[model samples]
Target: MAHVRSSAIRARLDWVRVHHGQARVEEVIGALDRHELAIRGAASPNLWIPFDAYVALNTEIDRRFGIGDLSLCRVLGRYTAEVNLPTLYRIFYKIGTPTYILSKVSAVWSAHYDSGIASSRPVPDGVIIRVESFATPHRCMCLSVLGWLEQTVTIAGAELIDAREVMCRLRDGNACEFRLLYREP
Candidate 1:
């Protein structure tokens, strides 16, 4: 099974606690506990946990807090970048262009996920990120990535004009791609 770093899971729960309050965090943990994916206690930042558990956490967040279309997963993803980038990956944003950051995605991808190869290429007004070979990819996961990429551009000192998923492995069974259009600040 694919795995995600524990820090990613912790960040999701942290966002919930900060925005929704401690009670909601407990409710979320209760929901996940039913599925045997307990996340109430902290885990080692670098520990690898089942990616499915991460997905379950995202799904639960969307089910309770979102509008049922799963779009809120994207919002949660943007929050992930907001919480994570400034502390853990700040230097990349400080010195890297959007393109430079895109180039480093592959390396970053490996650290966060045990599956998938993430790569990017420059487009006319932005960049196209492609995620391939991810085991058990889901639309919620893809949308989260779209949000993450959009936020990353903003953190890199650019104004994001548009961002959307161009392709999804769930539909095409190949890979997922996101198109992000931005203007330099």
Candidate 2:
């Protein structure tokens, strides 16, 4: 079973990385769309940061400053709406220590509002960083993750679909994977 699962994951990665050249989120989304994977709301016209670039940024920060308490890093992308559709900028953040792999961080937004009724504000979307202490095979972190995902999706009026896990380290020198996913409303 482990072999099969590993093989399946490898195959998926190969398809996404080799065949589709998923150097950017746009390419990954395109591949997903080509495979009939559903995405939340209308597609945005903005380009997504390449996974490597995003990782490099975080790794560099970690190496330079060392993990400190209350350190936050964010990656931003802009999506433009076409044909009366609302376009949103999705920002993903990597929070917490290197020894403990937690969750992915995401923020969904439409327009830029500072205050008042028309002020554009950031709506927290999905589990950005799944705390390692909270995740155990027996404990099933899915419930908590899903709870956060559901709330964010509901508030954003978007649909979220699949979740992907990326290997990362925690502050305690433990290796783990951080889970990330796309949603559809």
Candidate 3:
């Protein structure tokens, strides 16, 4: 299975702590703290965890968020804007159009997935990001990615038109394909 930086989980927890109640934030943080005995001692915020664990954390976030909707994705995306995107921005966003910046997505995504599970390419409308395999379906993750893409594009100075998943891995499609559509403002 693929792995993700624990930073993703920590960042979302920060968002929850600010917007949601403190108890729920602690609940999620506490759960991760208890993910294993050794982790309780001092898990590096940058440590890598299985992608499934990251997904599970997102699901728990939705549950405790009390809405259990794609809005959680919006929240995740907004938070991503504050932290993740800016770092990438400094590296990739040099007054480039969204298309130009997005052309670098394959590299950034590889750094996140840390495996060969993801790829991105420009299309007529925007971009197509593929997760080659996901044993389970996760709308929250998809939506969160969508939201992140939207924010990232906007930060790149593009006007986002729409974004959606056109193919689902669980639906027996070849891969989970997220289609993004945007245009320059």
Highest TM-score against the true fold, candidate = 1
Q: What does candidate 2's lDDT look like per residue over 93-158, in tens digits?
A: 122221111121311211111111111112243334433322222111222233433333333444
* Inter-residue clash pairs, candidate 3: none
Model 1 ranges with Cα > 4 A deviation: 34-38, 86-88
CA lDDT of each candidate? 0.83, 0.27, 0.69
Which residue segments of model 2 deviate by more than 4 Å? 1-128, 134-142, 164-178, 183-185
Q: TM-scores of all models?
A: 0.93, 0.21, 0.81
lDDT of 2: 0.27
Q: What TM-score should be assigned to candidate 3?
A: 0.81
- Model 3: weakest 10-residue lDDT segment is 33-42
CA deviation > 4 Å runs, candidate 3: 21-23, 31-45, 69-71, 91-94, 134-137
Candidate 3, after superposition: displacement of residue 158 in Å?
Answer: 0.7
- Taking the candidates one at a time, how many backbone clashes does each contain? 0, 28, 0
112, model 1: CA deviation in Å? Answer: 0.5
